[model samples]
Target: MTDVVAFLPGNGHVDARLSFAREKAQRLDVGFELRSVDYGAADSFEALLDSVLEQTSGADLAYATGIGGLVYLALRARGALTDQRAILQGPVLWGLETRTFPKLMRLPLMPRALTLAIARGPIQRRFMRKHFTRPLTPEFQRVFFDGYRDARAFERWFAWLTPRLLRDLEQQLRGRPELLDGLTAWWGGEDHVVGIEELRRTEAALGQPISVREFPSWGHYPMIDEPADWTAEVARALAAPH
Candidate 1:
């Protein structure tokens, strides 16, 4: 499989996460590449991820998380196995009913218009910038906002798709039974977005040869929280030869 599994980044995240992974591959002396979708209104997350992996010569793994991870699982659950393998890092296995969902959008009383308005405005970026462990480096700040600012174009074009992100997630966890078996990552002791108990229960429910670690120190953005340490593990995980 082409070099190694590629990494698909989460929404609006800039270079730090995937770049950290590249450093890991170099240290491990493994053949691998770190690339992510060039975010755009024209490309759905899965379409972009699938295109990247399809260009490879053989089966290869892909590492993805959050909505990004759900995109990969959506394809696998749908029976489109283009990649040789997939490695889910704290995947969005379930629990996305409120984030971006079609059913909720269909609900007459859902305040989606207001939500989208908030997300499209500076309000969302301000909130995002606040959540990071560190302020986004000034350089990333420019590029990050540049892309985020253009999200209105997408909101107009993909209005219906906004809620579907969460629906896609909930389906994989509840409707699809094929998501959990392939690969793994550290669960959590008290994950906020993805709880420790739910993660473990999801793994057990799948009942397959999956590997996971439980770390209380890290949260959802484990790579950002402990890049060097997580990268070391990811490097070894990739070297194992899927």
Candidate 2:
């Protein structure tokens, strides 16, 4: 069976948020796979980048969110996804003007202690609850807490998000605008995490209009807020012609 591959965010958790893609794959009778690299294990950022490139090497249809979306853009810009379809949800390509989390994580060793503190059970729950619309499910919360127990997960994600890397990705996409033809962007109208400005920067960098689907009432976690609706939308996108 063909696969509907999803590249997960930095935490690398196969959490409840991915069920939308899994259900859509089932409706299409395709396999579902969650892809993630251990940023914590990589010796250097280049190694992590290479792993991400390899993880997303080839796919008929792919789903990526946040940092994963950035990885997808890098691959697309490099001509690695010429004929594949990509569903990018809340891609953080730019728009860091107001966000302090990414900026703080990129700091020196001081952030390690901070990341570990945030990884603690209570803090993680509070942070996640803020982003989600509804209460967290037991299953979802279990995996989420388990996934971030290792502080390095958070540490390496920021390590990979250096300004130099972001600049290089923007330059590549701008230089080869044709490479992004197969991308479809999904955004929650109320999403504050990767808000409208980030989406605009993505379009500006690619130099082409992106196909976008906006969810009026949803925040950053549409799958957690309205799983069935998001799953149906995924099905529609997969069934639609490329």
**By TM-score, who's the top model here?**
2
RMSD of 1: 5.6
Report lDDT (Cα) of residue 232, candidate 1: 65
Query: How does model 2 fare in lDDT?
Result: 0.67
**Residues 75-176, candidate 1, lDDT per residue (tens digit)?**
565556533456666655544433344335455634446454545536656744554444456554455544433442223323333446545544555544
TM-score per prediction, in order, is: 0.62, 0.81
Each model's lDDT comes to: 0.53, 0.67
Candidate 1 worst ten-residue window by lDDT: 152-161
Q: Which residue pairs clash within candidate 1?
A: 59-84, 60-84, 100-163, 100-166, 101-163
Show how many residue pairs clash in every candidate, following the order shown: 5, 0
Error of 1 at 179 (Å): 6.5
